[model samples]
Target: MALIILAHPNFDKSFANKTIIEALENSKLDLEIRNIHDLYPDFKINAKAEQEALLRHQTIVFQYPFYWYSMPAILKQWFDIVFEYQFAYGSKGDKLKNKNFVPSFTVGSSESSYTALGFQHFRVYEFCKHLEQTAYHTQMNYIDPIYFHGTSLAAGYTPDSIMTNAKHHAQKLIATLSQLQ
Candidate 1:
């Protein structure tokens, strides 16, 4: 089973990420999703609890809206504290060995805009290096990320569009989990 980690800082204010989470909650993906904003509103993460959750699953999917080419702040903090010595890295640390780490995110800009010749001046993979490298360090198989781009000005985007894409993304995420399993 895959554990979908929800890390949107303001999920209530979000149109894309929120719908995606809702879709996963309704699906049968064997998901153990944790909303960072709700779980650690004050940023005090339960280390033991988080680690135990990690132990229970073989795949980890970080679902968040791309912020400044990375994940939301709380997720980065989760990585810093949760993935520590003797637990996620080093000779004794192998909690994530052979596990899959997939990053599924929403980007306001178009995929093309994340290229060298594009506005962002960096490829999506290049921007996601940190996530991939972290997975590598912990011996996790980094999977190709799923991205929803150009949604801000996607034209005709409405509540229906949000729900449709959310369900679609959720199904795709589940498909990826099935492959890993």
Candidate 2:
């Protein structure tokens, strides 16, 4: 089974992320989802429980909205707390070894703006090095991430369009999970 760690800070106000999660919920995939923000609103993470969940699944998927070229602060905090020494890394940290690590995120900017000659002046994949290195440090197989750009309402995107795209993203994610199984 796969474990999806949803790290949206303001989930109730989300469009793309919410739609994608809804689509996944409606699917028949054998997966578990942890809405971390809801689980730890006070920012108090249960490291033991998280480690146990990691042990139960062969694949771990991080679902969130890209913020400031990285993950939301809560997700970063989750990593800091949950992925502790002797558990996710270090001598006895083989607990997450051999598991598949996948990052699935939604970007508020357009894809075109993420190129070298574009506004962001860097490719999207470049931002994933941190995550890739995290997977490497923990001895997990880092799969290519799944992401959708142009998801912000401020980017002139309608809620319906975002919802439709999110559904497609969910379908692709479901297929990927099926193949992993």
Candidate 3:
């Protein structure tokens, strides 16, 4: 089964992330979705429960919006709490070893803005070093990330267009999940 850690702060107000999630719900794959914001609105993450969930699944998917070139604050907090030293890295911390790590996200900026010559000044994958290293540290397989750029209204993407793109992203993600199975 696949476990999706959804970390959107404003889920109700989301366009792309919400659509993608809806699609995934309809995909019928064996999935356990944990919407961290809703699950821990007080930011009090239950490490034991989270770790238990992790142990139940082979594929771990981090689904969110790309915020400040990283994940939402809640996810970072979850990682800090759930991925404890002796639980994720040190000796006797092999519970997560060999799990699949997949990052699925939506970006507000256009793809061109992520280039060296563009405003962001780095490629998308260049920004994923932290994630890649996290997978390595946990002995997890780092699958290539699935992302959709130009998802913001400010970037001139209409709701319909974003939804269409989100559906496509969901299909691609579903396929990836199937491959894992």
lDDT tens string, model 1, 67-126? 888888999999988999999999899988998899999887777788889999998888
Those runs of model 1 whose alpha carbons end farther than 4 Å from true positions after fitting are 153-163
lDDT of 3: 0.94
- TM-scores of the candidates in the order shown: 0.91, 0.98, 0.98
TM-score of predicted model 3?
A: 0.98
Better structure of 1 and 2 per lDDT: 2
lDDT of 1: 0.84
- Per-residue lDDT over 1-181 for candidate 2, one digit per residue giving the tens place of the 0 to 100 score: 9999999999999999999899888889888999999999999999999989999999999999999999999999999999999999999889999999999999998999999999999989999999999999999999999999989999899999888889889989999988998
lDDT of 3 by residue, 1-181 (tens): 9999999999999999999999989888999999999999999999999999999999999999999999899999999999998788889887889999999999999999999999999988898999999999988899999998988998789999999999999999999999998
User: Which residues of candidate 2, in runs, are more than 4 Å off?
Assistant: none
| RMSD (Å) per prediction | 2.0, 0.7, 0.7
Query: Which scores greater on TM-score, model 1 or model 3?
Result: 3
Clashing pairs in 3: none
